[model samples]
Target: MNLKGVRTGIAAACAVVSLGAASSAAAQGQCSRDTLDDIAAKYVEGQKQGSIFTLPVGEWVDYRENGQLVSTATGVISQPSDFDWHLALVDTGTCHVLVHGVILKPVPYVVTTQLAWTFNGLGQIRSTVVREGDANFDAKKTYAYASKEDWSEIPAGKRDTRQALLALANAYLDRAGGGAADVALAPSCDRIDNGAYSTNCEPAPGAAFVDREFTVDEAKGAVAVVSNRGEAEGPQDSRIFRIEDGKIRHVHAVTPSQ
Candidate 1:
């Protein structure tokens, strides 16, 4: 299946709106960096103690209850960004659980809604959460079997801090080129999102190509200033900031290429 076709529908617009809501919620929480750090530390501790069957989005947990060793419930550790966290309990004798939550960090930009883990007979953790998020914000909580191949898809090593920002720029370029389908490769992306631009651009397959040159500006937390020289449906030049994540968070256009 072409993931692009599915993603093209509202991925770009929703990403922007969701991010905005998240930012608003983060502001409302008034959670200081210290608070986030404390939470992170606590999560690490839970992992060390092996009590946390699964922790996703820097918060939230799913574990087996004591005694019966057949039921599971999810605990919310942080305020919801958009809506209250959702959980689905699965029964497999041992019980498998999934937790959904968001991680609102300055660096690693993550929005999780689906995370899975397994519990042992004694209600101890048997595995880590798999599939951190879903296409939509809905949480997927079920004890589905995960193959070895599933685990392999999990991202390894530290993510490129400049990815999200780069993606935003590339998204803009993709629109300028035509739509989401035009862009073949993942571009670096940062924070922020396209507004009207995101909606108007229809997904046109193989519309444009991007040749990017990046420089890390030390003064800006090693911010990546990207320049895109390419032809979408037409020629275009755009400047984008690269935030650390898998998707483009923000974008700006210097000259109209299409």
Candidate 2:
């Protein structure tokens, strides 16, 4: 099946998902860093049990799946199943979490999915975006980055400041696009492009990023940046950088479909 065609069809079903009208007063600044982690866990557990309605949600929840809008009562929630998330990067500052792994459901075929869940200060979920694709779309397979022992934490001597991490990640793009002559990369630097393994850090001409936006999680030692670079060319490209020992160890990229 043509995954691009499939994605297009889904995108046509765009609709906004809202729980209801906002309460007379909304909860503000109630979520802490640890609270975000709890919310993430609840999201995963709720999905696994096919009971997302039980979770705490804001008065208005905007959801998009595969570039298409989805409601709480439909899509993945409708066909609830088990999910094995390999890598999860949580940005506590922004209250956003990005997770990638395979969804184990018998009916619709097993596939890998990248999901970003955003939260509000009221301790409620505000937005969710999911991109689903089959194994063909997942190059590095699942858990390539998460399986590494030191992926979740950056040691004291290895941690880079937020500014430095952003620069290093951007430098990688510059070097990849030939704007820079040198870029720092770990000896075993590996890149997972759209769920597949790729030798992107090698000496070769690669696509340049455009309209880039970045978010850094210092505590997590991770950075999430998205831009337009692939053939489709929009804001659909995303890369998560795992910086370790002052070098980029792994990069998980989700590029747009052509």
Residue 258 shift from truth in candidate 2, angstroms = 5.1
Model 1: ten consecutive residues of lowest lDDT: 145-154
User: Which ten contiguous residues of candidate 2 have the minimum total lDDT?
Assistant: 1-10
Per-model root-mean-square deviation over C-alphas = 19.8, 7.3
Residue lDDT tens for model 1, 169-252: 456555655574333222422221211233222234444545443332211212222223343223323232323334333332
Question: lDDT (CA) for every model shown?
Answer: 0.28, 0.52
Candidate 1, residue 72: the lDDT equals 26
Candidate 1 backbone overlaps, count = 23
Quote the positional error of residue 231 for candidate 2 in Å: 9.9
* Model 1: residues with Cα > 4 Å off, grouped in runs: 1-29, 52-128, 131-178, 181-258
TM-score of each: 0.22, 0.67
Pick the lDDT winner: 2
